[model samples]
Target: MTDQLPLERLALWVEKRPDAVWLSQPVNGQWHDFTWAQVDEQARRMASALQALGCAPGERVALLAKNCAEWFIADLAIMLAGLVSVPLYPLQSAESIDYVLRHSQCKAIFVGKLDEPDKLAPGIPAEVMRIAMPYPTMAAQYTWAELLAAHQPLHEVHRQSAEQLLSILYTSGTTGQPKGVMLSAGAFAYAGSQSVREMQITEQDQYFSYLPLSHAAERFLVEMNALYSGGRVAFVESLETFASDLRHVRPTVFFSVPRLWTRFQQGVLEKLPQAKLSRLLRIPLIGKLVARKIRKGLGLDRARILVSGAAAIPRALLEWYQSIGITICEGYGMTEHLAYGCFNRPGQVRFGTVGKPMPGNELRIADNGEILLRCPSLMLGYYLDPEKTAETITDGWLHTGDKGEVDAEGYLKITGRVKDIFKTSKGKYIAPAPIEGEIAKNLWVEQVCLMGSNLDQPLALIELSPAAREQSQEQVTADLAQTLQQLNAKLEAHERLSHFVVVREAWTVDNGCMTPTMKIRRNVLEARFADQLGELDARQPLHWQ
Candidate 1:
């Protein structure tokens, strides 16, 4: 084992297994493989070409693209050239992209094939070198082909120290502007290696990459883990073909957000309406055969690990997947720690709790019940913001804004976000996230935003399922009303939702309702729907009936 960090790890792997497939992309209805040697050479050329453009050490290079082979090549090249890499969420609005680029002072950008580059191009700084990859774009930018053609490789030299800044990930805050979390090369390498151990990743494991790489969860868990373990990584062609791509890859280790897992649960449930179909299929003579068929059709038959995170997953949803012979392990972490904080072990899987902290990581509750974490993987600080950084990181503990409690066995049970909890006019503090997590168990309720902040009662904004909307409006409303009544009974008076509004549209990253990790933007949703929720107060709590 060498002392080389992550970038060096990639180079060493490529040198050892030059011809091994490092990445795969779907092309012409087939998966195309790119060997390790190919990736190494491509990234080297890109780095050298970037240097020719006067890119300097510690300068930022922004990558705006989906999960493609080029994304990884560009990322590695950035670090290899002793520059910082800032990955933008691919589905971000031009405005958000411009914000990140400007905030990070990115000197160059590498964008993937986009439907509309002109819209995003104008906002970028004129002095920045814009390079579009694997697709045609406007003339001011250099195509990826042109970038490589301009390569002038440098002699072998390791220019990075362990303490050098690796990347600056911008995460939205509850307050005014977003904060850029500055992380070091040591942080990524340490966390990535620890993840490989905790997740039990191996060279034989293949990963299907669909999640946005801009999110630290996917970047550390999938992208960086692939480099650490030499596993073949495959990118889905598009969201439309995600199912087909899964079947094609038969990936051993699969990662998804809680929302996607809910959809999968709902998709499976769609086949069996309300236990009537389940009863018919559960007969001793047919149960095994039917269950086997269901598993095979969903392409989950070969999946060894189907991990979900980036948001709290409901226990009810986990039980639903368990019934289908799929174990959904839910973990918890954030961008500041290179993502892996706590995860349940394979067999010791527990529902509703983010299991024991990874080795070398310590978790504790602060005086105010906020979750505090201490780890070598913790980010250095907020970029150029010493005051905010000092406030967040005190005495080696990263003050995670989340409130959690540790059980006797040391499992961390996330209660709610300290900043997100709303106080009702009744003087009762209600945490809406747990209630939202429970209501999300309803298959027809696709995505939910629970709002009550400084209000008398809470209201839920529900994005209905397609199947739910296909029913007559009266029937859809009736069923959801019944669900709300039952769910409300389980909550305290202040915690119960006063009314529900069903939205036909889905909350997605492209729409600015969700983040790159598929986490609902609470502040944005609250601002957008505050008045609409206030209108719900006219009706009584049980008025939905």
Candidate 2:
């Protein structure tokens, strides 16, 4: 693939297929398609408007919105204008929003529909220019229509080298403050092209955009891949309409994190009892028909590629999907690497391992068992944080915080995060992820977080599934005790759990327990439960709260 900027590719698509739909957004109750010409025209006008507002080249321009069609347009416009796009998660707190804006020194921000517009208003500086998207929001100086009508379409696209900064993607900050990751234009161009080629994505493939665009995985995988391959991208309206939207789009390619994948399985199990479903699937011909019907019902029958990443998925969950003829390929990557580190290719399938490194990408395990990667798509550095940047990238290799090992077949299996390993009072270190993954295999367990720190042994905080929550407490406790017994039997002495505490409340983004990408905020959860852990009896095998 040539080292052409995404905007250059968009320009080519506009010239070749002006009428072809590039983006689809749900409005009111129906889906609206935006053609390549429309995207180009709007992005050009957006660039012109930013230029009129005195946004200079290389200056940061923030885009704060949920997953929407305009988010992509704003990103392209920012790149076209030779400005850096700083995408902020819509669910970011007011404090985080202010911190990112101040850190990036963004001169202009494109605001769109948000869950809490009031929280955002106080964060944006009065001096910063605000452009509202099509969504109804009064938190902007100019609406999209007004800006397009007032400004002239910019005919000249700014030529940029591969090393030029494209966007500053902030980390989800599960442990500490979010750091801005500076990714170059070449990184996106290279990663996008590689993803398109590796996944065999083409203009005919359709992608559903439901994950936050601010995330590196979704941005590079879905948005950038679509831009590079001329694929159509469909945006989900809201969580309420997700199932309907998925059914409507029936996208050829689908990617989701492990949490969402588990939820999907839970949804299916809720409708059909697992025991009955398993019994039916034991039949030969009827099993195939049932599996196909089940896949169609989930709107994934048409999906040629189904990927699960952002976090490790349970092997049980992967096997469950595989039983239905859908192989969920688990991938491994990070924001610092443009999410192009390694992915399981079509035929080289591994159940738990995230397949071998992509073409031209180097993956080597450090002496400490941490994964080290060297790739063209690696980030330039962490924005304004030279010291941390140096710690992350050394000797031309990105030090992935994840601890993993490459198997004999070259497939990488992630063990856990280095920082997530907690030491017990006995001085033994335990990797919580594996234990958590094992506990999650029990269908009743929705979310599990293992913590020990200074405690004598590891303890588990588990959030039960909705179905499990409805069951009698005694029955739930008994099932969990059995599950814990099975899990502990396979674990080493130090890795064994002292007790399993049933968390009454579910962890959610709204409650500050989970990141926008649905990853549990370990620091937050640990802090919240710190006081209670001291009082819990280590002798107890199970505790109901």
Candidate 3:
């Protein structure tokens, strides 16, 4: 079983269970199912079309789309045609899109459902071939149905060597330009096979695919795991139908980012007040019943493995879910390693730590406390940027760039980013992650960034939750001041916050304040509020901006 790569695994599944439903996509309020054989046939036909269109073997082809059945088929077809796959973020800016297409020199692009096709159209160079998937997307030279009808299934399965380049997944840049991480076919094969084995995933399990598949974490979780385990994968049709689509799937294995998990909790609290929920949970037998009902309502009643990644989730959020019989295991990984690193196994999850290294992975702390990881699935290198790759990878261990400490029991807790540490005017260095984590525990705060950097005292730039924004500013301010005092008591004098400035604008992907994967771009936030924060330093403890 280990000898077979992804395409071989796909062939095995098709031969073993041709009629088994592998992909379920929602369109226009209707659901469509694609069996293993259907996916196999379509991918083969497309692979033939790509070859006939003059795409040479080992060339790059780009996939720009939302997560859907066709995205999977296009990726599979790329592999079948002996071409390397490059995935661009669906919400990526036009400038970034043009940069990647030009930098990678992709021979063609497969366009699918985009939020604004017109905004992305100009990014595609005129020379690159355009193929449109079966969705409302920009004009293309060839259509999905037209190609499938024009070509026959390519009988030959392109055999890829284990060391061959599989895909170039451009990072959703939070700091600088997105760099393509070159991963081998064996990298994902190893990570996915190991993950499924350790998590006890089986063919009977179901997977939900809503997160951006362009991100390594989501691709490893939803697509790779389903491929290795022969599980069926379902997708969300649109943002408006996310909740309903999630409930309809009830995936046995589910993964979400921290932002969405916080939103889920807020949704519950809005319907049933926290005070009422606390009371209902305190009753003995009724408490169990209430917890079960809540889990069922969230469609996580059947979830055997629920994971949260892309950013650190608050311990308070995890504890809240635990009270409701939902165990949200927070793991750690990066695009550089295909997101195959440390994980909190179901029976051995630690609250503050991303659990121990997996069986064959190595972990150590640098002299400066940066976490270093060496795994079998580490990327070959950053695409066409060996200087940057050399700076990142040394002696086979990927420098994670995040500061962390490990307990004697081997649990790893990320402290902060080495580059993110800031110094005060008084020359005291402070790590903002711990302080930010503490601030995030407050229910009223949606997002917070701690900044000081040569200032007299640190200040928190916060965004209010929707519910908090509705309440009186007086009520919110009073609560924040009390929480701030409590937090200051636990901090060094220089590390204490001076003010809390509420940001009026949202930090969304559209505005470029956050990455497509939903991690806040700290540099962008700081640059946006640097002047305002300095002006408000000597003002009041709290202000509504």
All candidates: TM-score: 0.94, 0.98, 0.98
Task: Return the candidate ranking by TM-score, descending.
Answer: 3, 2, 1
Which stretches in model 2 have alpha-carbon errors above 4 Å? Answer: none
Worst 10 residues of 3 by lDDT: 530-539
Residue 199 error, candidate 3, Å:
0.8
Candidate 2 local lDDT, residue 107:
95
Cα lDDT of model 1 overall?
0.81
Count of backbone clashes, every candidate in sequence: 0, 0, 0
Candidate with the greatest lDDT versus the true structure: 3
lDDT of 3: 0.92
Q: Where is model 1 more than 4 Å wrong at Cα?
A: 1-4, 136-140, 173-175, 271-277, 537-545
Candidate 3 residue pairs in clash (backbone atoms < 3 Å): none
lDDT digits (tens) for residues 164-281 of candidate 2: 8899999978867889999998999999888888788999999999888899999988998998999999999988889988988998989999888888888888988899899989
Question: lDDT (CA) for every model shown?
Answer: 0.81, 0.89, 0.92
- Give the C-alpha miss distance for residue 286 in model 1, angstroms: 3.6
TM-score of 3: 0.98
As for candidate 1, its clashing pairs are none
What local lDDT score does residue 209 receive in model 1, on the 0 to 100 scale?
Answer: 92
Candidate 3 stretches greater than 4 Å from native: 1-3, 537-539
Q: Write the per-residue lDDT of candidate 1 for residues 147-212, one digit (tens) a residue.
A: 787775545534777799999988854345667889898888888887787777888999989888
Q: Which is better, 1 or 3, measured by lDDT?
A: 3
